[model samples]
Target: MAVSHYTLPSAKLDKPAKLLIVAAPFYREIADDLIAGAKAEIEAAGATYELIEVPGALEVPSAIGIAERMSNFDGYVALGCVIRGETTHYETVCNDSSRGITLLGLQGLCIGNGILTVENEEQAIVRADPQQMNKGGGAAAAALHLIALARKWGGARKGVGFLPEAEELRIAGELKDNPTA
Candidate 1:
């Protein structure tokens, strides 16, 4: 299989913006690295964050829901590691957690899903290291991107809106036709 590559845009996060992190302790080794990377990124962005540890990936959604409702955080990050075994449990956990995180983001919450679903420990190792693949850092970057997009579009205090570049150009064209009218 070919290796998949991705790049994230660099954006400055709003300083002092509240952040909440929910991590799974089931895969302690990998989880630790992920948390470390995410924390470092959040701090580098000049934001303050709190971490809540859950038993495993399955419990992450409830923890996130509680934190989101309790604190006025601008964004949330969910970190976990699930390596597939010879059982169907892996599929359930991975799918449910992903769906839960997506729902949270859709509910006007900025969430960075750092959950790593890999085929084995080796894959997890590659993605969890702060200095290596850095999936955790990637999650933090995604959170910052969503936060910036939210601010530019408008806060959740108001409903989300979309104004495409082409739409802006069309409006400008109409305005120019009127001139001083």
Candidate 2:
């Protein structure tokens, strides 16, 4: 089958950011390649990162959640490889891991998910290779993009509820003075 790729837009940030990389090295070689690519990408964007290893793909997301709660990382990169096996474990890992990441993202965590769910080792190698699909680098780029967006909108927000006392009094005075009844 033919493959197509579309890269997300990247932008320079106003300040450098820190990222946490949660990797699952069950497939050591593949995880190494993925981590290398992710590091290079983060460096290219003028950001720094810390790497932490978990047991497998399923644990990657939990690690990220822990770091988010306990650390001050600006973003996260999740890297793992789940090759289809003889049983249904592959499906569980792939689905639950992705779901966790998605939930974290919905909660406003900037994350790049590089977990690979492939049919075989060959496919995993092709996708994880920095010189090939470069999924690791792609994940970093995704996180960077999210960080930029968060910073761009990180400012004082206007409240939509009740107005402050001074403004309320001023409006009340105006209404009293302009009464047509």
Candidate 3:
């Protein structure tokens, strides 16, 4: 497994950062483990997080979307477990939830998706354990990296669009005073 070679990304933000953790605890124990791992990672990075629980994985992304639109979180962590079952429901939940999270990320949201689409509970537990795969922590680290990148480049300006309103007004005034020149 590539697990042996995987290294967690180191992150340190320039300013205090707050994150929103949206957990879909349909599998309560798995979710708890994931949340624990994620919290440890966020704390270690010197960041704060607020956690909110939804019904299941399907709702995780929508919760994040709402938070992103109405709240002031710097990043988001999506935690959940979708264990494959006898019915096709597993595929639906897994695909839809993943697609939703991906769409949100594409829209420029800093999100760490820790939702586990596992074949069984054993796999979920193993992946969620902080000492093992620690997928939860990995997700948080991913989000932190994105957040740091956003902070680093988010303020940079290109050309005309970034000109301050005051500067634009000053330029306009100069143009008006020197109409003939």
Candidate 4:
């Protein structure tokens, strides 16, 4: 029932980061507003971003997944609007797109999901407005937080095979113990 949530300030980063915004422009105006807010948020966080358009909400996640595999972005923002009409297609779009984004996040990719699933255009407009609910900015903020978390825990190690150097040492040790030696 509530779209407004408490936002945490973005963490200060020692270095600049690059981000990708994979947006679905299904509702041109709505998507535009969402993208605006997301851009503003990313700028405020001092991160550079690239914007790419997909055909629909479902494709937004797929695009980010591809970028995660092939690109060097530190995080991603997914933007789209899925308005409910007189059909069950609404639920499918909303649920499946959201699930796809979640799965990507679980795979260690920092993603901000700003897709709006609403009963009507009015609700989407209200939520997408930068001066109102600002869901797009919220999503951007979420991604930034996750990126900070990733950076905080990055570097240093706990296990063998985690690094190539450690793996090679382990292989050498195994070879040393071989009976043929």
Candidate 5:
């Protein structure tokens, strides 16, 4: 079988931005490599990022979710590894984590998932290698792309002359300009 490798062109931002990396360090070595690559990519694009550690793969999405709700990160990178074993827990972790991240994206949060799902240590090492697959960098790029898209759509940045709901209703003739009642 032929293997295909794909990468997003480096994302260039229009302005300085902040990102957060939520890493699950079950495998410390692998997680470190992923974070290194991700940070490099983010900085290369003229952006800054803050890093935080979580317990395991399952918690990665939850950390991002909480940050999305209560923090100011412009984007997020999710880094972790889940290796398959004899038990079914691997599938649960991988599936639920991915689903959660997807849900957050659907809600319009920019997120890059660098979590590695592998069948063995060798595969994990190859995928996590900063000089090899560089999935971490890829994830950062994905987040940047989403951020760019959001900015393009004016996410929360209404155009000039945008008005509040009450003003808009009056302008649309939905309400009287001067009402006593």
Candidate 6:
């Protein structure tokens, strides 16, 4: 397997941020690990978070939307695991969930997607560990990163100032690597 490394950005925790976590219970084991990892990162960043369970991956987007509409959370983390099956149902769920989450981000809601789209259980196990470069934590990091950027950009607007070329390239790579909704 190819090795990959990520440098976590320093979290400015002068004021704790409120976070909402929407998790799918269908894949309980994997989802649990992802949640645990996210919780760890949230605490480490000096933030408070709440976890809300949903029936499955398909429900994550709606839950996030409702939470965003009703609550005052600074960000959201969506956690789920979707493993490939005999039919094309996996593809549909993956694509729709990803698109929905991406839309949420564009709508100015900070969302961290820890949803795992994999071929089997082994891959899920490897990626869910808190100490093993958790994608869950990575998602949380991305959310925080975006939140910081949004603030620096002075809230939502039709157009924004130019991002450093290197930073833009880095974000593009991250989005391509994990296309979750």
Local distance difference test, each candidate: 0.83, 0.89, 0.87, 0.86, 0.87, 0.80
* Residue 7, candidate 4: alpha-carbon lDDT: 67
**Candidate 1 clashes between residue pairs 3 or more apart in a chain or in different chains:** none
Top TM-score prediction, candidate number: 5
Better of 1 and 6 by TM-score: 1
Q: What is the lDDT of residue 20 in candidate 2?
A: 97
Per-residue lDDT of candidate 5, residues 1-181 (tens digit): 9998666677767787799999998999999999999999998899999999999989988888788767788899999999999999999999999998888787778899999999999999999999999889889889998888888778643222236677677767877846432
TM-score of each candidate structure, all chains considered together: 0.81, 0.83, 0.83, 0.83, 0.84, 0.80
In candidate 3, which residue pairs clash? none
Candidate 6 has an lDDT of: 0.80
> Between candidates 1 and 5, which one is better according to lDDT?
5
**Location of the lowest summed lDDT over 10 successive residues in candidate 3:** 155-164
lDDT (Cα, tens digit) per residue for candidate 2, span 1-181: 9897667666578999999999999999999999999999999989999999999989988888788767788899999999999999989999999999998887788899999999999999999999999999999999999989889989422232356776676666865664442
TM-score for model 5?
Answer: 0.84
Q: Which ranges of candidate 3 are over 4 A from the true structure?
A: 1-3, 156-181
What is the C-alpha lDDT profile of model 1 across 1-181, one tens digit per residue?
9998868656665545777888997889999999999998888788878888998898887777777766677888889999999999999999999998888788777889999999999999899999998888778878877887888787575222344555556656865654443
**Mind giving the per-residue lDDT tens digits that candidate 4 earns over 24-117?**
9989999999999999999998999999999999998889878876778888999999999898999999999999999888778888899999
Give the per-residue Cα lDDT of candidate 1 at 115. 96
- Worst 10-residue stretch by lDDT in candidate 1? 158-167
Best model number under lDDT: 2
Stretches of candidate 2 exceeding 4 Å from the true structure:
1-4, 155-181
